[model samples]
Target: MPTRTASCTCGQLSIEVQGAPTGVGLCHCLACQQRTGSVFAALAGFAAPYQVTGSATEYVRTGDQGAKFIFRFCPVCGTNLFHTEDGITGRVSVAVGAFADPGFPAPQVSVYDCRRHPWVQLPPGAVAFKKDPP
Candidate 1:
C-alpha cells in the first residue's frame, strides 16, 4: 500500500493517508466551485486509519439535499483540506490538489456534470453523472 501526505497551502495542517483511495472523483457542483474558487474540485476519498496533524478550523453547512457537511481547513491559510458528511462515517474527502503531486491518478468519476464548464474536459473513460450517484 502507498502512503501519501497532503498539506495545506501554508503547511500548517497535514494529513497522511495510507493504502489505495476508496474513490477519486471530480465535483462540478456550484458549492464545490465556490469552495475551491475553481471550475471544479478534485477529491480523493480515504477510509479511517489516516493520520492528521496540526490544528484545523471546521465549518458546517447544510447541502441542498438537507444533509450537513463539515469542512475542515487550515486555520492559517484557510485552505480547504477535507470534508465529511453528517450521515457518512469512516470516510474523508481530501482535496486532491492539496497533495501537490503531479503523478496522482486522474479522477475516475465526475459528479454534477451539468454544472461543469463547457470548456472543461475530463480524462478519457471517466464516468460522469449529472447529479449524485444513485
Candidate 2:
C-alpha cells in the first residue's frame, strides 16, 4: 500500500503514514468508547517512520490489565488521533476514522467483546476476545 494521510477534525493536526498497517483492530473497552464517544474504536497500527505534524495533547490512563497508555489528540479539535501503551514499543495505534477513508481495511480483531454493544455487528470472521488476549 502507498502512503496515507490522516488529519484531525479541524485539520490542524495530521500524520503521514507510509506502507500498510501492521494490524487493524477494534476495541470495545469502556475507555475506548468514552474516548471516541462511540460504541467502540477502530484502530490501525503502524510502525516507525511515520510523520506527525502540528500539536496534540495527551491523556494518560491505566487499562484493566494494569497497563498504562497515552492517548494523543488534536489540541484544537480534540480529535483522538492515536495511542501508545507502556509496553508497546515503536508502534502507534491510529484512529481509523481519522483517515476519513471508507475503503480503509477492515479490522482483523475485535477486543473487549464483553463491553461491545449488544447491537453492534462485527465482520463475520473477525478474531474476537472477551478481554485483552493473552
Candidate 3:
C-alpha cells in the first residue's frame, strides 16, 4: 500500500494515510465554500488505520440534513485539515489541497453542482450531483 502525508500550512498538524483514497470528491455547497474559504472544497476520504499527529482544534457543524460533521483544524495555523461525520465510522476526509501535489488524482465526484460558481468547470467525466448523492 502506498502512503501519503498531508500537513497544515504551519506544519503543526498532519495525517498519514496508507493506500489509495476510497473516494475523491469536490463539494460546492455553501457550507463547504464557507468552510474552505474558496469556490469549492476538494476532499479525499480514506478508511481507518490512518494516523494523525500533533494537536488540533475542532469545530462541529450541522449539515442541511441535520447530520453533524466534525471539522478538525491545526491549532497554530487554523488550517482545516480533516473532517469526520458524526455517526459515520472508519473514515476520515482530508483536504486535498493539504497534499500540495498538483498531480493528485482529480475529483471523481462533484456535489452541490447547483451551488457551483457559473464559471468554475468540473473535471471531465466527474459525476455531478445537484445535491448530495443518494
Candidate 4:
C-alpha cells in the first residue's frame, strides 16, 4: 500500500492516507465554487485508517438535500483541506489541490454541470451529471 500525504499551504495541517482513493470527482455547484474559490472543486474520497495532524477549523454547511457538510481547514493558512458529510461515515473527502501533485488522477465524475461554467472543460471520458446523481 502506498501512502500519500496532503498538506495545507502552511504545512501545519496534513492527512496521510494509504492506497488509492475510493472515488474521485468534481463539483461545479455554487457552494463548491465558493468553498474552493475556483470554478470547481476536485475531491478524492478515502476510507478510514488515515492520519491527520495539526489543528483545523471547521465550517458546517447544509446541502441542498439538507445534509450537513463539515469542512475542516487549516486554521493557520485557511486552506480547505478535507471534509465529511452527515450520514457519510468512515470516509473523508480531501481537496485534490492539497495533495500538490500534478499527476493526481483526473476526476472520474462531474456533478452540477448545469452550473458549470461554459469555458470549463471536463476531462475526457469523465461522466457528467446535470445535477447530483441519485
Q: Whole-model Cα lDDT per candidate?
A: 0.93, 0.92, 0.95, 0.94
lDDT of 3: 0.95
**Per-candidate TM-score against the hidden true structure:** 0.95, 0.95, 0.98, 0.97
Candidate 3 lDDT tens digits, 66-106 = 88999999989999999999999999999999999999999
Q: Highest lDDT: which candidate?
A: 3
Clashes of each: 0, 0, 0, 0
RMSD after CA superposition, every candidate: 1.0, 1.1, 0.7, 0.8
As a TM-score, model 2 comes out at: 0.95
Superior by lDDT: candidate 1 or candidate 3: 3
The CA lDDT at 38 in model 2 is 97
Using lDDT as the yardstick, the better of models 1 and 4 is 4
lDDT of 1: 0.93
Off by over 4 Å in 1: none
Q: Write the per-residue lDDT of candidate 2 for residues 63-101, one digit (tens) a residue.
A: 987999998899988999988888878888899999999
User: Clashes in candidate 2: how many?
Assistant: 0
lDDT of 4 by residue, 1-134 (tens): 99999999999999998889998999999999999999999999999888999989999999887889999998988999999997888899999999999999999999999999999989999999998989
Cα deviation of 13, candidate 1, in Å: 0.4
Check candidate 2 and list the clashing pairs. Answer: none
Best by TM-score: 3
Task: Tell me model 2's lDDT, rounded to 2 decimals.
Answer: 0.92
TM-score of 4: 0.97
Q: Report the Cα lDDT for residue 43, model 1.
A: 99
Model 3 worst lDDT run, 10 consecutive residues: 61-70
